[model samples]
Target: MAAPGCFMEHIAFLEASDDPAATTVWKEHITDDESEGRTA
Candidate 1:
């Protein structure tokens, strides 16, 4: 697992990007991990 601060920074970077697809994919990946009881 990533350090919490690093994870948040990565998320912020993704959100700041112009690529919606990348952000959407990242969100979906996080959702899937959560559903499996895994930490992002």
Candidate 2:
């Protein structure tokens, strides 16, 4: 329900994230150990 080309951006929040892409965090949360192959 917002205007076109305009939306709330959460980059500030994400930039402060411990897991920027939420990749590893989600993997660990779901008990998937495969994230060990990831490179930062």
Candidate 3:
């Protein structure tokens, strides 16, 4: 498992990236978690 800080950094990097693929990936990640009743 990734450390919490590293996971947060990855999320920050995804948010800062302008690439559409990155945005899609971020959206999918959030959606999956939300569906599982998890909060970001």
lDDT of 2 by residue, 1-40 (tens): 3334454332223355676566434322321232233343
Predicted structure 2: lDDT: 0.38
Give each model a TM-score: 0.22, 0.17, 0.22
lDDT per residue as tens, model 3, 1-40: 4443344325444356677684664333554456456766
Candidate 3: what lDDT? Answer: 0.50
Q: What's the distance in Å from true for residue 19, model 3?
A: 34
Task: Report model 2's TM-score to 2 decimal places.
Answer: 0.17
Model 3 TM-score?
A: 0.22
Pairwise lDDT winner, candidates 2 and 3: 3
lDDT of each: 0.53, 0.38, 0.50
Please give, for residues 1-40, the per-residue lDDT of candidate 1 as tens digits. 5543344324444457687775665433455456446875
Give the candidate order by descending lDDT: 1, 3, 2
